[model samples]
Target: MSDYKAFRVELKDKIAHVAINRPDKFNAMNADFWTEIVDIFRWVDETDEVRVVVLSGVGKHFSAGIDLGMLAAGTHKYGKDVGRNAELQRRVILKLQGSINAVDNCRKPVLAAIQGYCLGGGIDLITACDMRYATVDAQLSIREVDMGLAADIGTLQRLPRIIGDGLARELAYTARTINGEEARSIGLVNRTYADHDALQAGVLEIAQEIAGKSPIAVRGTKRMLDYMRDHSIDDGLEYIATWNAAMLQSEDLRIAMTAFMNKQKPEFAD
Candidate 1:
């Protein structure tokens, strides 16, 4: 695993656990922090050994939004270095988007385990995951309104589809904090745990369950589902067929078929 100053990457049993390590700062993303995040995600995606990735924070809160100290001091400012400002601005936005997009776009499935305060950018990260679990103490908000900006990362886009558009809008506009129980009721979180330890354990267990499946089939399923949600039935069918055409030739197909025939477990070689 690549080293990170603001995070730790632990890989075991084909699962990657990435923990935000800025507990003293509430896990806020600083320039160096997000740089580490981007690199680690790219590293994780490049490996076949990693089948599932889980994101969590190590602190009393997931994050207290972007660092206000940094914001007030304009640490987010960008300059194009003598005529690159415009492109730099776009690149900056893309890079920030990438903090979560890297997680979303990883080949393997990702699960976010949230605890304590999940605000602003934290919402962006969790929303991009394939699934989310939160602790009872979790407090979440689409906090961009208070920060004088829009939720530019992924939350504004993906959250509307997960929770209703109305709920997403209300949260964005009001910037109200909602606890984990309400988050579960509104479909923002797939499950809830009584505390941080349970939250992490639950997500890890779920990740292992997914890891036990056929990697090719599992990854393809995630990709096809994403396509189906965005495309018409006809388009989706053509895409899925195209995807399975090559995947069906793999040894995994033979293993699964033989396992069924023999009434035994399939041991897929990833």
Candidate 2:
């Protein structure tokens, strides 16, 4: 596995765990974080030994949003001239978007395990994942508005599709914090465990289960599902037909069939 300054990555039993490791800063996103996250997800896509990824934070909170210190230092797109500065900021926004898109476009599934705070950019991070689980006491917010900014990352785009447009708009406009139970009730998270330990255990169990599946099938399923989110029903069906035409020819299918017939487990190759 690649060494990451902002994240702790561990691969075991075909499941990769990626935890935000900046507890001293409440895991806030900084320059190193933006750079490293893209690298981490790209590595996940390239590595055949990994099947699923569980994303979490190291301390009591998931993330407190982008580091204000970075902004004060003018680390992001900033220029002295207005015209050039606007262009520079636009470029920076696209770069940040691409960084989060790496997680969304990853071939394998990503499951987010949230504990305390998941605000602003943290929401962007989790909304990009395939699924999200949280501790009951966790707090979440779409907090960019409070900072006089629209969330340019994945949250505004992906969250509306996950929850509904009305609720998404309400959260974006009001910048209100919601507890984990409300997050789950509104379909932001799949489930809310009693505490952080339970959240980690639950998400890890699910990740392990996903890893146990044929990697080809698991990856194809994620691809098709992501496709269906934007395409029409007819378009999705046609696409899946084309997809399975190639995918069905895999040896994993034969192994799966034989395993079912023999009532035994099947070992699939990468």
Q: Which candidate number would show the highest lDDT if scored against the true structure?
A: 2
Q: lDDT per residue, candidate 2, 59-161, as tens digits?
A: 9999998888877776455657899888877787889899899999999999999999999999999999999999988999999999998889988899999
Look at candidate 2 and give me any clashing residue pairs: none
Q: Where does candidate 2 stray beyond 4 Å?
A: 75-80
lDDT of 2 at 166: 99
Cα lDDT listed for each candidate: 0.86, 0.92
TM-score of each: 0.92, 0.97
Model 1 Cα lDDT, one tens digit per residue, 1-270: 666888878999999998888899999877776678778888887888888998888878777666666545543565547457567656767878877777778778989898998999889888888998998779999889887888888888899989999999999999999999999999999999999888888999999989988999999999998887688999999998899989999999999899999999888887
RMSD in angstroms between candidate 2 and the native structure over all alpha carbons: 1.3
